[model samples]
Target chain A: MCTTCGCGDGDTRIEGQGAEGWHRHADGTLHHHAQPGAHAHGATDPRRLRIEQDLLAANDAHAARNRARFAHDGIFALNLVSSPGSGKTTLLCRTIQALRGLLPVSVIEGDQQTRRDAERIRAAGAGALQVNTGKGCHLDAHMVSHAIAQLDPAPGSLLLIENVGNLVCPAAFDLGEAHKVVVLSITEGEDKPLKYPDMFAAADVMVLNKIDLAPHLSFDEAACIGYARRVNPQIRVLRTSATTGAGIDAWVDWLAAGARAAARSATQRAGPRGVVA
Target chain B: MHELSLAQSVIEIIENAAARDAFARVRKVWLEVGLLSCVEPDAMRASFEAVSRDTRAEGAVLELVAVPGRGRCPSCGTLSALAAREDACPSCGGYGLRPVAGTGLRVRELEVE
Candidate 1:
C-alpha cells in the first residue's frame, strides 16, 4: 500500500520460502521474521529475479506515458545530457542563435542551485524555465511536467530539456524527449562513450562540440565517432564549434525536421481514431 | 557518483512501499545494475549503507545483480556480452558496435517485513 500512489498493500510474497517461519500474529498479520542461521531455502532462486523485473515494469510504464504525452503535445523535446563543463549550455546558446527566428523554441534548464543557465537562455532571446533539483541528481518525469507547466509553450513548440550535467542517472529517467542529445567536448577523451555507454545508448544524437579546440587537444575525432557508433550505430553524430560557427546549421535543421515530423504525426493521430463527431 | 543519488532514490521507493504495505522495516533490497549504465556497484553499495542507516531500510542487506552488457556487432553479425567497455568485436575485431541492452538502472525488488 503506497501512501503516495495507493498501490502497495497486498499479500506477502517473500523472496525465499522457509528461511524463517512466517507466523500469523494475534491480529492475523503475516510477517517473515528472519531467524539466525536460516538456510532453509535455496540461495539462488528464479522467482526472485522475476519479482525484480516486475518492479522495473512499473517504472517503465510511467516512462511510456511520458513519451506518449510528449508525442501528443506535438513538441519536439531533446534531453541534453553530458558531464559538467562539456559545453552543453554553450552549444545550446549557439543553437538558439541558429534557430531563433526559424522555430518557436523553449528551454528547461536543470541545475543544483543557481539559475545561471536559465538566465543565459533568457538573455539569448528564448523562453527559459529553470528547475533547481536541490539534492536530486536526475530530472524525473514529474519534474519535467513541472518545468513544462512553467515554460507554457504554445502548440507545436520545440522544447530543449537541458538535463542536470550527468551521464548516468539522467539516462534512467525519461524526460519525455523525442531525442536525447548528448554533448561531448573534445577536451574529454574519446573513451567517454565506452565508459558511459548508457548515456550514449539513450542519446539519439551525439554532438561532439568544441571542435574548434580540437587542434590544440589530442582528442581524436575518428576515435570519438567510432566509439559513439559502437554504442549506438543509429545515433546521428554531429561535430560543432560554438565559437567557430561550424555545424550549427546542421543541428538547427535536424531540430526543425524533428519538430515538423512530430507535428505531422500529432495531427494525423489526433484527426482520426473515432473522433467525437 | 550518480549511483549515490540512484541509491537514495531506491531507498525512497522502498520506504514508500513499506509505508503503504504496512511493513515496518526493510529486510533486503534487490537491485539491478546494468553493465553499460556507468553506475559503479561499489559506489552504489557504499551509498546504500551510508544513507539507509536510521531509516526504514536501516541495516538492510543489498543484493546486487549485474546485467551483462549485450551488444550487436554490426560488421560481424554477432550478439555477444560485453565484459567491459571494449567495443571491438571479440572474434572479428569489428568497429560497428550497437548496444542491444544493458543501458539503464532499476530498483528491481524489495523485501520488507
Candidate 2:
C-alpha cells in the first residue's frame, strides 16, 4: 500500500509501457526500493530536526533544470492546462495542423489512462509522446523531464505539453513550461475564474474556447474576461472555436511569437560559435 | 483533492530528512500551511494518516500552523489581510492587489527519534 493518498502504488510509465530509465522517487531520489517494509532503522534518541524546507523544493529543482534545458535547446514549451473536456486536445490538433510545415512541433500528452490523445496528435502529423500518470492528478517537472528525454525534439522547436486536465493541481506544480496556457470553454460557467483563481492567476494566457456556440448558449463573454482580469490583470485572453477554426490565427500568432523569442534568445546566447580557444 | 499528493510529498520530505539526519522515527511534524495555499488542513491531516502507514512518520502528530493571507494593494500602498484571492483592497477597493505573504507550504520543523 502506498503511504500517500491511499492509492495503490503503480509505477509511472511513459508511452503506455515500462520505462527503462531510472524512475524518480517522490523525494527526488533515483533509487529503486526493494519493498516498503524491507528496511528498518536502528533505535536512536529522540531529537528535533529543523527541516525548514519547502515541500515542493525537489519538484522546483527539477523544474529549474527542465527550464534550463529548454532554454539551451531553444524549445518554446507551452503547458496546456484546463478542466477535463475543455477542448485541450482539439486545440492542440488545430495548432499542430496549422504549424506543421512552418515549424517543427511536438506534443507530450498526460492523462490517467489511454493513448487516444497522443494518437490524435500523431495523426495531426506531429511526433507525440504519452505519459500515464496512473493515480496522480497532475504531471510534475520530473515526469516532464523524463518525457522530454525520451522524445527529444529538434532544437528551436515548439513543445506543447498537454497536462492532465486539472485546474487546481497543475497550477501549483510547475512543469517547466515557458508559459501556461489555460483553456476555458464557454460552455463552462463564466464564474470559473473566480472560483479557481489560482489557475487563472498562474496562467499567462486564457483561451476562451468554443466561442462559435456563443450565439446558441447564454454564456457571458465579457463577465468571463472580467473575472479573469480581476485575478490576473496581465493575462491575455483569446476567444477561439476549434470546430469552425475561428480565432485560431491569433493563437498561432501568439505561439509563433513565443517561439521566435525563444529562438532569438538561444542564438544570442550562442554568440557566434566555432571560436576555438 | 491534491492534498493527498501534498501529504505524500510531506512524507517524502520527512523520509529523506530522516535518512540524512539519522532518525529512526518521527514523533511530530509542524507544517506551515498558508490560508490561500488551496490546501485544506483537515484533508491534509486525513491524507497524512492514510499515506504515512508503514513509514517512519506513521502515527506522527501533525501540528499545522494556519498562516493568514496577506496582499499589498498597489493603489493605496497598504498591506492588508486577505480572505480570498479575489478580495479587493481594503483601503482603495482596487483589484490590483499583489500577494505578499501566507502562500507558503513548508515543513517548518520536526521532532524525530
The model with the greatest lDDT is 2
> lDDT per residue, candidate 1, A1-277, as tens digits?
2122122355343223211223332343333222322213335432222233332344455566767777887888888999999988888888888887788889899998899999999998889999999977877777787677677776677888999998877887776677789999889998898777778878888998889997799998898888887767777898888889898888888989999888888887788787642
Taking the tens digit of each residue's C-alpha lDDT, what string does model 2 give over A21-84?
A: 2233444322222233322232565478888888778889999999999999899999999999
Clashing pairs in 1: A1-A8, A1-A9, A1-B20, A2-A8, A230-B97
Best candidate, DockQ: 2
Q: What are the fnat scores of the candidates, in the order listed? A: 0.19, 0.50
After superposition, the stretches of candidate 1 with alpha carbons farther than 4 Å from their true spots are A1-50, A53-62, A273-277, B12-21, B72-77, B95-112
The CAPRI class of candidate 1 is: incorrect
Error of 1 at A219 (Å): 3.2
The per-prediction i-RMS, to one decimal, reads 10.9, 12.8
Model-by-model lDDT, in order? Answer: 0.73, 0.83
Candidate 1's DockQ is 0.17
